[model samples]
Target chain A: MDAAVTAAFDLRSWSAAHLDRVESALSRWVVAEAPAGLGDAMRYAVLDGGKRLRPLLVLAGAEAVGGNVQAALRAACAVELIHAYSLVHDDMPCMDNDVLRRGKPTVHVQFGQARALLAGDALQALAFELLAPDDEGIPAGVQARLVRLLARAAGHEGMAGGQAIDLASVGLALTEDQLRHMHRLKTGALLQGSVLMGAACGSADAQAQDALRRYGAAVGLAFQVVDDILDVIADSATLGKTAGKDAQQDKPTYVSLLGLDRSRAYAGELLAQALDALAASGLRDTRALDALARMVVDRDN
Target chain B: MDAAVTAAFDLRSWSAAHLDRVESALSRWVVAEAPAGLGDAMRYAVLDGGKRLRPLLVLAGAEAVGGNVQAALRAACAVELIHAYSLVHDDMPCMDNDVLRRGKPTVHVQFGQARALLAGDALQALAFELLAPDDEGIPAGVQARLVRLLARAAGHEGMAGGQAIDLASVGLALTEDQLRHMHRLKTGALLQGSVLMGAACGSADAQAQDALRRYGAAVGLAFQVVDDILDVIADSATLGKTAGKDAQQDKPTYVSLLGLDRSRAYAGELLAQALDALAASGLRDTRALDALARMVVDRDN
Candidate 1:
């Protein structure tokens, strides 16, 4: 194929194939075995879910570094579990209080509040458990690295910290920088951690690691920017979550601060930066990473 | 001193000294560095008070095996963090809904519900982060093993699952076997995991490991049996929590299943089994373990 033709390579087939693997891995790992209702709630939160963007990022990063597929698969599923648990907790009455998510009732809405709380807690533990399985296929060093990255990304300094900021910032005007910082920790940390974890699966030289980190940062910010835009532009049916939630909650967002037009332009700039980092990565096969960046910027939801 | 005099060594000084170390490690590790309210909430949930039995068990287990003190300290604090987070979440309005814990307002009662929820979530993540720090003082293999042990003990098949069963069986009558199974997973698993995690910090032969596991299981269940007895007999002020909560919530307990006398006897039996296993381990310096096992059964609160 010509260069232009290859540049326009179809991501649909790639996503479909990888999504199948991600779903199967998630299903096998997230079992409804014990604790009866709690396991069911965990499975409900994680399985048959929203877009598997974090897992895709992980797999794509692994491919870029020629990493181990088994480790990448585990990393991918682990990140998704963290994401799913966050969503479950965030939608509780004490938090965002949303009734709908991914076109279905939230875990709390479906399972009641206490069960939802336990389910989220269990899911978080399961993520770490999956990362550090007793199996010999994944090296102890890799397991340790993955746990370190994921734990930091999910902990007080990362996603949970961001959520706290978001909670405290409700009805308060935030500067563009403050908003960016909040999103960077809340959503950006885990997204970046996913890329690093994927890279950790095998080996990446310093240059490649640095480039991947840059790509991850750009893509992570772009994701939140686009999400803010989608909350404004898309309907709840299309978004698979309550639309315009930020505005309704009086929470500051990208569109709220930068305006819709500027937010769109900012996402475009981030997409370009992400692609630039990929180009500098000195890796031959980062097509998927490039494609995922575009998808993040262009997706309606 | 005579052997009898040495055997009757005071546990207070020993516990006091080790508790000082555990507190310092926790204070150093669980910082209020960023995200504003989150650090405060996490600190509030973890610091100040609790029996710190899990951390003591970890230290004692490590000492018995001639394990690394640094690794054991980290594991000790990590288990305590998990225990603290679980209590924070369990005390929320949606769960047990108690307002008092450790002689003060619960996390949700002091911090708002949302912040309390986030704090608990962040604390759980922090537990894993402590287990897998970037420092090289703890080996990668040990880190992986610790993460695996903690995760399983805390996840659905263990602590969370036990909570689920407890929630579901609130009004239902449970058989002695069923109740034993529930307590084994809920409280017993993490206590057992603490001993195992401490042992993982150093070398333990198969025979020693098996004996420690048995000892851990016995002490873990005995702790709960004694807890149930205390709930019936102790006052809230003495317990530092709302006493008789299990009965108030109409939850089943050992005292309810077997009469108070039989329940007390069962606790004694379990304590005896724990000491027997420790003796079989062929480890000379298990003075702390022996003392801790006795403390679990004899403590008033």
Candidate 2:
């Protein structure tokens, strides 16, 4: 295999181990020994398969700054939980009303809307709980920073704001700037958090954190652009979920606005920008960062 | 007016002033000079009329312990923002589907579901942001504690968990214990946070915090039970929003499970328990706590 593919597979293995650790910690903190049903929905929401890209960025960011991945793992899980909660709630009847997620019935479809909503709310709370553990090894200030960042990213100016823009632009064809603004808040912000959180892991210098943030923004938008491209080319079997749903929903996408060819070009440009940011940070280990940039567009999923 | 009534009204006014200050600060922090429209939806969500009861409790809890109310104000406003967010999301089409709230169309009704959802999410983030202001004088550990407490109350075992139970038991007949569990999770959790936060406001002893927590828990349930009763007895005009909708939906309620008279008695019992907890704390200036406990069931909204 080429170095790129080898790195992708290697990073996949590396990120999976960290993710498993995160998932285990989450299960311990959230699930009680009894009342299995209440926790069942939580598990269902968390365990649903995804790329684990955000968590990987967090670990990578931390590792780049000589911090242990283990220290940052809880935050990794917390961000994922926030992301999962968003999806569950977003699929509700009043929202996107999606039935299939990851090729399975959505949480609301299986657990009912009320439970789904509650599950989402609970998950959001769990994110914070995970960040502010009873053990105070992490500095209180850092924990507080984590709380503030995650909350803002998950809330208005970031993900929620993006979703608001998306919702408002449903029928209308939004301008390129408008679409970018929406995507930046919705997807870019969380991805940025993943990186910023990693920088936060072991007192990484502020300059490094700032550089990684730029990298995160570039990668996040590139990830979305690739997604829009894949929706047209990839089949549901390879994608492991519904494909072309964006087009069907008439949701404005990079491909719809910029066309597929230009969108792919944009992804490449963003990947370069991300790498440039990492280089600017004066980081020596580019292995994980390099792998992530390649994986953003190259993966079938 | 009775002394209790007079005190409650005075508190209502005083709390409003504090809330206005907090709201103004929040607007300054979150909104920008440009993008007036983007910030407008969020500003509306925060500025909309509601009794700032949660913030009042935080201030009350602080004053009860002889702490500076100004020091506790940020945390108070943060909790209230979270509460407001929950209300916005809860009234969306996927959840309660209510059109009116606080005598106005619900966020979703006014801004559409997507914006409403986003607004709710944003507000949640803003609450956390408010908790950890950079130049603020509160200790970092205390702020971290506040964030953790609020997170737990809002998350799985508190408000969200309560919401899950409520969603699960919509048509089913729940036992009295199950009903209490729901209310405790949903409403009791935040209420408990209010008291704990208040106790944390100054340098109250742990014992005092614990006593106030018990007081909070008791009063939380009392408050919800009163809400259940009011829904049964009060008209929409009096309540300022939809009334009798809970029963119409056939959702489980305290009154439904225990009957109206029994529910009222239970509320009284809870109020007494709250008072006992407050008294056990040995607070000298029990005026705020006393007024708050009385106000739990006395007011219309």
Query: Against the true structure, whose lDDT is highest?
Result: 1
- For each candidate, what's the DockQ? 0.87, 0.49
For model 2, what is the alpha-carbon lDDT of residue A15?
65
Residue B300 C-alpha lDDT in model 1 = 96
lDDT of 2 by residue, B85-129 (tens): 888878877678898878888777777776666667677777777
The true-versus-predicted C-alpha distance at residue A12 of model 2, in Å, is: 3.5
Model 1 CA lDDT for position B140: 89
Question: Interface RMSD computed for candidate 1 is what?
Answer: 0.7
Question: Model 1, chain A: how large is the TM-score?
Answer: 0.97
lDDT of 1 by residue, A1-301 (tens): 2364356667899999999999998888888886859989999999997899999999999988888888889999999999999999999999999999999999999999999999999999999999998875789989999999999999988999999999999999999999999999999999999999999998999999999999999999999999999999999999999998989999999999999999999999999999999889887688888899999998877
